[model samples]
Target: MMLKAMTVAGFSLFALVATISLDASAQQDDNLIPNDLAIEAYQGGWRSGGSDPTKECLAHFNSKYPTKRIQIISTSEESRKDWKGHVEYKYQCTAAIKLK
Candidate 1:
């Protein structure tokens, strides 16, 4: 009976450890990285005639990290800015995601 009890306890411990390890690894894989932000603007924050810089950011991350992906978590903020003489829409983004 003692031997059986020990075996059961050992199995339970193993199961607990496995659960925790999986959760921990999952958390590790989900990395919070910056630069996923995409802003619609000119090349120099000018009023208009630019593109999203964050697209390159995400692409770079994808190329640098194998099997990892970037997701736009949020559009953190947005505002209107006057550049030179043009009124442009500005956006601040919060981005995070990863595969490992």
Candidate 2:
């Protein structure tokens, strides 16, 4: 009976640890910008017409979220025909801010 109780307690501790870790990882993921929104920001920056599209996009993000650390995780370019010939730049980003 004592051995069974100890085993159950150990399992419970392990489960608790697992749950906490998963929760932490989920919280971290929540800080990341969704892919579509990141791409939208990049496109908006490009449409604004500047010397550097990437820099423009970063500036937009920084201006919008003054407190967070914004990082571009990935970027891609594709050529498209809309009003003529144009290239679209897409970005994937993560924004993290410290909690008080």
Scanning candidate 1 in windows of ten residues, the lowest lDDT window is 38-47
lDDT (10s digit) by residue, model 1, range 17-82? 222225788877786643553322222232343545455445544565546556654443233655
Clashes of each: 0, 0
**What do the candidate models score in CA lDDT, each in turn?**
0.45, 0.47
Per-residue lDDT for 1-100 in model 2, tens only? 1222224645742222222236777787786555444333344422422235456557767787676566664444433445855554433333333222
Model 2 poorest ten-residue lDDT run:
12-21
Q: How far out, in Å, is residue 8 in model 2?
A: 44
TM-scores of the models, in the order given? 0.31, 0.33
Off by over 4 Å in 2: 1-53, 81-100
Colliding residue pairs in candidate 2: none
Model 2 lDDT at residue 98: 29
How far off is residue 55 in model 2, in Å? 1.1
